[model samples]
Target: MDDMIAGGCQCGAIRYSLAGPLPPAYACHCGECKKQSASAFSMSIPLDYDQLQVEGTPISFTTTAFSGRAKHNFFCANCGTRLWHSGSIPPDSITLKVGSLDDSSGIAPQGHLWVSKKQAGIKLDQAIEQFDTQPDDVTEWRGNLGQNS
Candidate 1:
C-alpha cells in the first residue's frame, strides 16, 4: 500500500512486485482474454516486462492469439490462479491481471481495449477512454529499469 504495487496468486504460492506507478490499467474485451479469464473482460495493468519480479515459478500455458501470435499465460502452479501474460507485443512488457494485485484500491481501468469484441450488455462508462485496438507504440512509456533476462 506504499504506492508500489504488489500481489500474488490465490494460495500465496507466487508473488510479484511493481517498483513504480503502474502504466495505465485497461479492460480488454478481446475474446482471447475473456476465454482465458472466464469473465466478461480482463482488467490489466501494463508494465515493462523487466519491471516485474516474481518469487516463484509459474506454470505456463501457451495459446495462439486472435492476431495469430503466440501468447503464454503464467499462473500459480499450485492454486491454478492466473498471474500474468506475455508475448505478441513488446517482449519488454507483461499484462498483469488487476485481480492478482494485493491492493487494487487506486487502480481503475483507464480505457477499454479491443472494444469490438466486448459483450453486448457490458457498456463502458463514458469517462473512460476506449480504443478499437492496442496503442500503436509504448516505447516512451518504458520503465526506469535496466534490461532483464
Candidate 2:
C-alpha cells in the first residue's frame, strides 16, 4: 500500500505496517484501558484486520472486559510492550495503539469514550465529543464527532 505507516515495539521485537489513511482515533478512559496502558487513558485507531501487516511473533492475553466482551491484547514477547488489542465490542476490527506508531503525529483522537470511568485528576478535552460509555455503534460515535466537532 502506498503511504504505509509503520511502527514497532520498544525493543524492536514486534513490527507492523498499516495501509495509509487509517480511521479516526478515540481515547478510552475505561479502567481496562488505564490498567493496560499504565496511564489515565489509552488511544487507538481502529483499522480493518486486513489492513495490518505484522512482522513479529507477539504473545496475547485474553480477558473478559467490563462489557462482557472478550478483549485480546497483543504484546511483544521479548520486551512485553503492548502492540495492539482487539475486542468483541468492535468485531472484526483491531484497535491499533497510537502510542506504538513510529510517528504518531499523523494520528489524532477525535473523541473520548468511557468518560464516566475516567480517573480522578485525569483531565480531558472538553472540545471533543465525550461518551459516558462505549457507544453501541462506532459509526454513530464517529458521526457524532463529525456533527459536534
Candidate 3:
C-alpha cells in the first residue's frame, strides 16, 4: 500500500485524498492549459476514478478538449479553484491538478505534452520525454514515468 495524500481547494471548500504512490505527473503546454493555469504549463496527475475520494460538491463545466472531445472541469464554486478535470480517455477519468495538492513541493512532471503550443522562451527538461504534440505511444509515455505499462 502507498501513503495517502491530502489536497484541497484554495478556500478549503473542496478537499480530496488520493491513495498513494501518486502516479507520475505530466506537464501540458496546450493553449487551453496555459490559459487556465495562467502560466507556462499546467501539471497533471492521472488517476483511476476510484483512487480519489473527495468531500464537498465541486462545480463543473464541459469544454472542448484538444482532442476535440468533451472534457469536464471540476472546481470549487466558492473559490473558483480548479480541483481536477475529466477527460474521455477513460470514461471515469480524473486528472488531478497538481497545484491543488496541499504539499506539492515534490511535483516534477515526468513528461511534457503539446510543446508545439508552448510559449516562447520556455525551456523544458532535457532529461524527460517531450512531444511536440500529443504522443500516440501510450507505453512510451508510461515508461518515461518509470511505470511498467
Off by over 4 Å in 3: 88-91, 137-144
Clashes of 1: 1
Estimate the TM-score for candidate 2: 0.85
Candidate scoring better on TM-score of 1 and 3: 3
Give per-model TM-scores. 0.79, 0.85, 0.88
Cα lDDT listed for each candidate: 0.75, 0.79, 0.81
Q: Which residue pairs clash within candidate 1?
A: 49-92
lDDT of 1 by residue, 27-102 (tens): 8888888887889999877676678777988878888865667788888889888887888443455778889988
Candidate 3 lDDT by residue in tens digits, 1-149: 26889998989989989778888889999999997788898998887767878899888888998667789888899998887888653337677899999888887888888989989999887887788887776435644574522
Q: For every candidate structure, what is the RMSD over all alpha carbons to the true structure, in angstroms?
A: 5.7, 3.0, 2.9
The superposed Cα distance between candidate 2 and the true structure at residue 41, in angstroms, equals 0.4
Identify the candidate with maximal lDDT.
Answer: 3
**Model 1: how far residue 129 lies from native, Å:** 2.5
What TM-score, to 2 decimals, does candidate 3 have?
Answer: 0.88
